[model samples]
Target chain A: MTFLRDTATIFSREFAPVWRDPLSLVFTMAQPLLFLYLFGPLLENGTDTPGPAWQWFVPGILIMMCLSGPLMAGYFLLLDLIGGSMERLLVTPVSRTALLVGRTLKEFVVLLAQAVLIIGLAVPLGLDPHVPGVLTGLTLLVVFGIGLGGLSFVLAIVSAPGGELFYGVTQVVMFPLLLLSGVLLPVENGPGWLQVAAAVNPVTYVVEAERALFAGRFLDAPVLWGAAAAVVTALLGLHLARRRMARGL
Target chain B: MIHARGLTKTYTLKKTSVDAVRGVDLDVEPGQLVAFLGPNGAGKSTCLRMLTGLLPPTSGTARVAGHDVTTEAAAVRARIGYIGQKGGAGEAFRIGDELVTQGRCYGMTRRAARSRAEELLTVVGLDGMFARKPSTLSGGQRRRLDIALGLMNRPPLLFLDEPSTGLDPASRADIWSHILRLRADHGTTLFLTTHYLEEADAMAERVVVIDQGRIIADGTARRLKADLAGDRLTVTLHDPADVPRAAEIAAGLPGAAGLASDGPRLTLRVAAADRALPEFVRALDAAGLKIDTAESSRPTLDDVFLALTGRTIQDEEA
Candidate 1:
């Protein structure tokens, strides 16, 4: 009960300010738009047939949106820690489990919101985001974002940088995940070793399964791997982040 | 309440191992406010961290509010409020919601958490800053808010680490006032560590002075000062050359720890001036060295600490 309470409190308190800041709000909306415009038609128009290309690009964009939400949340974790804010929080009756769960869930909630906004916008761009199926797929994406964000928080916590180095780490975590997710191009077309690398990339399943959902195409292979990826990543992030926070290092 | 026996911690840094808190034993009732005073690197912070269960001791056991901090840290945390040396609010959230989140984290319902936050903000003198962001607060204000957050659960014990480090004089007084009143209002035990000698002397009922990972002295400020050192006497002679004669004269007095020439003045440590001053002055007149002026004052905690440890409290930090 205390865990849920703490987590929810952290979620609401943390997400509220980001929601209010106009600049952050504009950037959040603009991020996916920039990605869609920059990566979308460039890859699609470059291809012989742009129709299927847009279809593929839509899922990729949505996953990227989901991925960015959690990755950015790590920045907050790092700020709290280095500023001595997180240390102050520990002085209270708050359980470390609650602190970890609350902070991680807050990031997940934002990523979920971003996923919804992007997935909703994807429909008119020559792509079919089957509402219910895409919602479920993005829900999985939100879960994935939570896990990734948790990992990000732990990284931010562990890195514990002072100033400009913080934003540097944020971009480092974010850009790599976006590139590796195979959001814009087919995984097989990349380098052979990169193809082998993509097999184990949970983010690969995220884009493929989400793209399949957005295109309204039911694949022969089930999306169990993507769902598992979402759960495993989220839990792993939660477990490790919780342990780290508890140690109060 | 807290009871600790043989509480010890050793931190092995990259190359060297530091025994932060070698061995300590202490007892506190449910509502006592005991101040721990030490200079920089004196291990006061390390001991508080271990006592609060933030850091595990390398050896020994501690019970906070009757719960073992090692085996039942969850319960120990649940029962105490901790305000660390650094204010720990992250960049996200309004001050109000941060307090609410803290309340909820300790098991308050949403409505209860909100109400409790409102009450605590007022108590901590942050009533008007509810909607304001934490990033907007000044250092002292942020610390007060941090205190409010620590009190969210109304824990039985509160561990405050350097609560007055960077505050202005007025702000420090304001905080000390609140700390003194907390026990009366909430019956909360406060274990505070501070580098300010005056803060510990003026506020705490009992003081513990630690130096280099060991307990150098522990007692009420009065006893520590009175038992360890005598009152200091500063005397000025009419002529500078008369200092040596005055020193030789004062040395014969009962309980007088020989006089020393301090620049143009002579100073001595006397166990009891009331009993020895007259005889010492008679001897001084016999030596034909006139005592121009003399003054005696009780020793302070700083003197006691310096006397016992062979070094002043702020000396290490400097």
Candidate 2:
């Protein structure tokens, strides 16, 4: 009873800060759009600077979105942590797991909006959204958002100043992940070590999945790998965050 | 219901895990107001956190409401309401919403939550600010809301970490007044920690004093004070800065058995000051020290603390 009640209560209430803060939404969406509009095209259809622009670069862009999603979650969670908001929640008969689940569920709304904006921009840049392409893209975004939300919850725990020092650490960790995910260019041509890191990067799966979506078909290793990655990362992240929440994080 | 036996907490901060709470045993009954008195970082907060299941114990065990703190936390959580030293409610929502959600987490229906919220808002004297965000409320109002949030489920056991820390005198009075009302009305078991000794003296039924990770004394305030009778005296030293010198000056006197410094004031052991006063003064003059002002007075809780811990709580706080 506490778990069900707490999940509903936490989800409904916690979502407000994200929705109500106009600045949070504007700032979160702004930079991603600037890159989409200004730089997204620079890599389009063999600009002669390097290899296949859309083939390699698109996945990285999508992966970057996934990896960075939890950074947003980390920011809000840490405030609540230091502010004693999360500790108060722990005192309740609230469900430990529900705290993060509710958060991930709420972010589905933001994920949908991000997907629409991305697709809207993608169309102007001449990426055709065939029926299957659009459907697969939407599915991937759902998985991506949930996965990111869970990771952010985990990051938020470690980010707790008393525990993990999340702000400085996350900021630094986020950048290299973006570069290695190959959001700006292909990491395939980078050094062997960087190539390995990119390959192992969960965002790479997102990029690969997005590539499949853009091709008007979704199948093979990439889509399965992406979905699997999201599922595993979410479970792991939720597990860690729940431990912290349970132990009074 | 709470029982802790040899409870200890050691926190590992990268290089070292210092023991914050060490070998403490306590037993508390339901609906009693027990005050945890200590200086800052004297393990009061650490012990309270463990009792409420907020921090894991480094060693030993505690049971609250029949649930083991480490193994049965969710059950312990269900049976208790814990308001920490800092205001800990969700700040993004309206106060009414926050209280309602708290109620619902205890398995109450929406209508039930609303009725309960209404009752509590009125109880904490926050009726008009139901619709305002907690982030927008004044400090006193935020603290009131913190109490309301802790009480939403009508928890059988309540833990308040410094229930009064920062507030104007008026607000402190108002908050404590509300707290007394809640205790009378609900008979809720209460445990609170505070650095304010007077607050403890004024409100607490029993006082447990801890210092340097150990329980120095535990008894009713009256009993602790009674233990200090016939031996303590308040006297002035000629100079505040020369307290050490004054201590030696008082110590050499024949009947001055126990002597201690409390800032400019010196307290010494004497069975009857009237019999020993002339000789003590003559010895001070012989020692070439004039009394600025001196009186042998009845013992206070401050003296009680000093007698038990060998250091006053004020010095520990400093």
Candidate 3:
């Protein structure tokens, strides 16, 4: 009970500034919105994928947001660590897990809101709605995001008091994960090695699952693979980040 | 409310290890304002972090506010407040919201936290600035906000790491007044680290001096000064030729040490300069050595450190 209360406290604190200004949330969504309108139409004639460009590109955009959004969540934690606020929070009686969970919950909320906005905008662009399927796909994306957010927090804690390591690691890791995941383009037409690499990349399974789910193929093999990948990532991210929090910065 | 034994912390890098705090043992009674004094990298912050349950010790044990810092860290954290070296309020958050969040972190209800935040803001003289961000505040105002956040829970003990460092003289005094008032009103046991020798000497009831990761001296500032660094009595001789004889005569005085002579000026340390100055003068006068001038001065805390380590704290800081 206390853990939940502490988590709520942290969540509220993390969310308060966003709730106040809200313009910042729009700025974060700007990049995804740009991709949705401008680059998304470019996929109309270029791809041989089964569905309209909106259906194919929208879920990919949501997955992309899930990737970048939660993966960058640690930057705030890094700021707290560099400042004295993190130390202040650590000295309090608040549960340590609550600290990580609370911040991650805030990231989840923002991701969900942004995902909904992106989906709503893509609907007018001739995207058909798969209500339950999209909801389930969002659930999977959230699970994956929680894990990515957790890993990001671990990176933040490790890079504290200087923060160079956090920036360096995130920059070095984000691009490869995004490109390899096939969120923007299909890897099926690529070389055998590239296909093998995509097969191994957990993000590729998530993107595949998202694309299948958005097209209402809930029972597809990619859905199971993506679910497994999401669950594993969430578990690993939460475990490592929680352990790091327990061990102290 | 605090006790520690054999507390140690060591950082092992690639090929070598540095002992940040080595075998520190400390005890503090309730409501005592003890100043932990040291130069840079003297383990003051490290010790504070351990006692506050923010950092685990490399070895040994500490019980702060009746809970083991390692095993019962939650209990320890609950019973103590720690204001770190940096601004406690997040720059992106409003000061009031941060204080209320701090209160909530300690399990206070939202309503209670809000009221306490308002009350503490007033107490710290930041009453009307609740909605402002920390970055907008002046250095001293930001420090006061940090204190307000630390006091949100009203813990029995508060550990402030260099509370008055880098502040102007007027602001330092203002912070001291708030700290002293907190102790006076609620009997908050303050264990604060400080670089200002005069602040520690004037404000703290007990002083614990750490040097090179070890406690070198701990006592009342008066006791440390009188015991380690005695008063100084200097005399200017009428002739530089009489300096050696004056030094010999000054050395013969009771409780005299650190004797030195340069040219016509002769100086020596004594337990009480009042008693030793006149005796040394009479001896010199009887030896047919005329003295041009004589003066005696009491030693400061810097002198105590110098007497103990052969280097002044200011020199070490430099």
Candidate 4:
């Protein structure tokens, strides 16, 4: 109970600043909207995957939004490290796991809002996402956001010179994961090696699940796999973040 | 409130190791204000970090406020307030909010934390500036906020790492006055690190001088000065011709050592300026040399440092 209270306090602490500066919120949402509006349309007529182009593209855009939100969490952690804010909190009696959990939950909340806005925008653009499936997909996206954000926090803590190392390494890692996951393109019709790689990518399962849910395929194998992938990613990410912080972060 | 034996910290770099603090033994009684004096890279900050449970020592052990720093770090942290070299308040929060939140971190209820924040703000003389952000506060004001944050829990012992390092003269004096008041009112034991020799000389009841990761001298400033660095008497002759003759007469007297003349003036290092000055004056008068003026000066902490280490803190800094 104390852990939850402390996490709430930290969450409020992190949220208040971003709330004060609405420009940060606008900027955070702008990039995903730009991708959805600009790059999203270019793929409209290209894919012949037996569905409306918007339905096929919306899942990728949703996952893209999820990835982008958590990817920036590393930068926030880096700022806290450089600014001595992390050290300030470390000296306090607040639970170490509470610190990371608080920030991860904040990112999760923001990512959920972004997911809602993306799906709402898609509905008007000829995308007919099933209500129950979209709800389930949004829940999975929240878990994925926490996991991804937790991983970012870990990267920030373990890496020396947290800023450049996190950015450089995450950029290298994120692009490969995104490409292999078929967020922007279908891997089914691609080369056999690409398909094999996509099969191994955890994000590929999430993207496939979202694509199935977007087409109103509820209670399917894709949903189970996507939810499972999100849960595993979340567990690993949270555990890594908490363990790193526990070891003198 | 602080007791440590052989507390050491060694940082292992890529292929080599640097011993930042080596086998330091320290003890401080309750309510005693100790000024930790050292040059840069003397491991003062590292020592403070170790004691406050902010950093673990590489070897040895310490107990701060009755909690072992290594095994009971959380207990130590709960009992002591550490104001780091850099102010601990974050950039985003207002002064009152920061203090309140810090109080909550120590398990205070929100109402209690709010009241404590108000009381501390008044204590630090920041009553009207509660709404101001930390970044908007002046350097001295920010330090006061840091102090307020540190005092949120009202710990019996407080550790301030260079509290007045970057402040102006008036601000430094202001900080010292508040520190003294904290000791008087709450009996908070203050163990502070500083670069200012005069601040330690004038303020601290006890001064611990560390050099090259070792405690070279530790005592009251007066005792350290009188024991390590004796008083001096500088006599100026009426004419440049009288300098060597005055020096010769002064050197013959007891405790008048390091006698040297520069131009029309001659200086002698002596044990006690009060006892040695009159005899030296009589000797100079007996030598038929007319004295222009004479003055005796007591040794400062710098002098003590120089005597102990063969290098002044300023020289070490350079």
Candidate 5:
């Protein structure tokens, strides 16, 4: 109970400043919103797979939004390190887990808000995903955010004092994940090697699950695998973050 | 309140090892304020960091506030406050919010934290500035906020690293007053590091001088000055020709060292000015050497450092 309270305190501390900066909040949602409006239309041309353009595009945009939330949240940790605030926090009685999970929790919450905004926009653009389906997709993204945000926080610590390396590595990893996970296009229509790579990407399960939900196909294999992947990622990412914090960042 | 034995820290990078702090043993009774004096890079900061449980010691044992630093760091931290050279307040936070958050980190309730923040602000003389952002504060005001934040947990011991390094004289005095007040009112044990010789001499009851990662001298300022360094006597002869004869007489006196003649002035160091000055003057009178002016000055902390290490403390800092 104390651990949860400590985490909440840290979470509020992180959230308060971001809440005051509406412009930055708008910028966080801008990219995914743009993709939903611009590239989202290009999907209307119809792919080799059977699905409406908006249904396919909505899931991809939601995943894209989730990817950015944690990546950007990592910068806060880097800033804290450079500013000596992390050192101050280290000397306190606050648990290392609370310090890490608190920041990631803020990222997860932001991703959920972004997911809501994207889904709200998608509804007017011909998105017909049902209430349960949309709720499930948002839930998956929240869990995925925890995983990704935790990894981002860890990466920030790993490349501390020189954050450019963090950006470079995240970009290298993120682009590949996006390409292979069928966010831009269905992996089945791609080359054989691409299919094999997509099979290995956990995001593939998320994208597939969300796509099925967008099509109103609930209670399917995709949803189960996606939920499992999200939970595992969240657990693994949080665990690594806590371990790195304990060893000193 | 503090005890450490053979506390040491070594850093190894790319097969090159640098020992920042060599074997150091220290003990301080409760409510005693000891000033750790050293030039930059003298391992003063490293030792403080280890003692406060911020950094792990390479080899040593430290018990602060009844908790082993290595094995029970959280307990040690809970019992001590550390005001680092750089202020720890976050740039974005309002002064009050930062203080409250720090208190909460130490497990204080929200109401308790807020009320304590209010009291500390007044204690540090930052009463009406709670709503201001930390970045908006001047150097001295920001340092005071750092002190208030450190005290949020009401720790028994406090460690301040160069607390008044870059402040103006008035601001430096302000910080010193607040520091003394903390000790007087709460009996908080302070272990601070500084290179300012005069401030340490004037403010600290006990001064520990560190050089090149080793404790070279430790004692009360008066005792150190009287034992290691002596009173300085400068006699200005009416004629430059009298310097040679005066120098000879000064060298002949027992415990009169560092005798030098420049122009019409003859200067030398003596163990005690009150006893040595009278006899030296009578000898000069008998020699028929006219004495224009004679003055004796008490030894400063810098002189004590110079007497022990052959290098002035200020020189090392420069």
Candidate 6:
């Protein structure tokens, strides 16, 4: 019970800045909105997929937001570590797991709100609604986000006091993960090696699951694979992040 | 309220290992304000971190506020407040919100934390500035906010690392007054590290000096100065030829050491320059060596540091 309370405290503190500056929250969603309107239409007639572009493209955009949003969450942790705010918190009796969990909770909340806005906007653009499926897809997205955010925090701790490593690693790894996951374009037409690489990429399974769930397919193999990937990522990320927090930054 | 034995910390970075703190033992009674004095990179912050349970010791043990720092870190944390060297408030968060959050971290409920935040804001002279971001505050105001955050838990022990390092003199004095007031009001034990020698000498009840990962001196400032760096008495001779004779006469004086001569001037260290000066003067007169002028000066903490390590704290700071 104390852990939950501490997690809530941390979550509220982490979310306070965004709450005060609503404009910054909008700015965070701007890139996804841009992809939804501009690059989204490019897939309308160009792709061989059997559904309206909105159905196929909206879930991919949500996954994209999930990837970018949580992958960059560590930057704030890096700032706290560099500035001494994190150290101050560490000295307090707040549960260490709460510290990581609270920040990831903030990420989950932010991703949820963004996913809602993106889905709502896509509804008027000929996208059919699958209420339960969309809800589950959002759940999967948040689960994956929690994991990614945890990894980002782990990176932040490792790169602390000087955050150059955080920036360098994130920049180098983000695009490959996004691209190989087939978030923007399908890897089906690519060579066998590329498909194999995408097959191994956990993000690819998540994207496939998002597409399947959004199309109202509940029992697809992709859903199981994506759910497994997200759960595993979340468990690994939380374990590593909590261990790092416990060990001290 | 704090006790440690053989507390040590070593950092193994890549191939080279650095012993940041080696075999530190310390004890602090409740309500004692101890100023930890050391140069930069002297392991002052490292030792503080270990004591606060922020960093685990590589070996040894510390019990702060009745809990072992290693195994019972949370209990220790709950009973103490630590103000780090940097601004503790996040730049983006409101000062009041940060303080309240600190209170909440210690398990204070929302209503209680809010009231405590209001009270501490007034204590730190930051009343009505709850909405102000830390980035907008002046250096001194930011420091006060840090203090308010540290006090939110109302812990019996508070550790401040360089609490006034970058503040102006006026601000530094302001900080000291606040610290002294807090101690008086709550009898909170304060263990703070500081780079300013005068602040430590003027404010702290006891002083602990560390150098190169080892504690070299520990005592009251007065005692350390008197024992390690005695007062200096200098005399100007009527003739340069009399200086060598004056030096010999000065060495003969009881409790005199570090006798030196330069041209017509002579100087020596004595436990009390006031008592030794007149005796040395009479001896020089008996030898028929006249003195032009005599003066005595009391030693500062710097002098004590110099006597212990042969390097002034100011020189190390530079």
Kindly give the stretch of ten consecutive residues in candidate 4 chain B with the minimal lDDT sum.
B251-260
- When summed lDDT is taken over every stretch of 10 residues in candidate 2 chain B, the lowest stretch is B226-235
Residue lDDT tens for model 4, A200-230: 9999999989988877797789889998999
Q: What are the per-model numbers of colliding residue pairs?
A: 5, 3, 0, 0, 0, 0
Which CAPRI quality tier does the interface of model 1 achieve? medium
Go through the candidates in order and give each one's DockQ: 0.59, 0.56, 0.88, 0.52, 0.54, 0.89
User: Per-residue lDDT tens digits of candidate 2, residues B174-290?
Assistant: 889988887898898889898788888889999998887899888887677656534455667767877777788677655566677777888787656666666667777787776
User: Comparing 5 and 6 by DockQ, which wins?
Assistant: 6
**How much lDDT does candidate 4 score?**
0.85
Query: What TM-score would candidate 2 get against the native?
Result: 0.83
Clashing pairs in 3: none
Chain B vs. true chain B: TM-score per candidate: 0.90, 0.80, 0.95, 0.93, 0.93, 0.96
* Model 4 regions lying over 4 Å from their true place: A18-24, A48-50, A158-162, A170-180, A187-201, A216-232, B236-265
Model 2 per-residue lDDT tens digits across residues A129-173: 556776676677666666566667776677665645676677777
**Local accuracy of candidate 4 as per-residue lDDT tens digits, B174-248:** 988889999999999999999899999999999999988889999999889878888889988898987877877
Better of 4 and 6 by TM-score: 6
The alpha-carbon deviation from the true structure for residue A85 of candidate 6, after best TM-score superposition, in angstroms, is: 1.3
In angstroms, give how far residue A144 of model 6 lies from its true place. Answer: 0.9
Q: Write the per-residue lDDT of candidate 6 for residues A123-229, one digit (tens) a residue.
A: 88778969999999999998989889989999988998888999899999888888898888788878999999999999999999999999889999999999999
Tens-digit lDDT string for candidate 6 (B109-172): 8899999999999989989998999988999999999999998889899999999988998998
* Residue pairs that clash (backbone atoms under 3 angstroms), model 2: A59-A207, A159-A166, B31-B189
Cα lDDT tens digits, model 1, A137-197, are 7677777877887787778776785645557776775666667767667766779888877
Q: For model 3 chain A, where is the 10-residue window of minimal lDDT?
A: A45-54
Candidate 2, residue B280: Cα displacement in angstroms equals 14
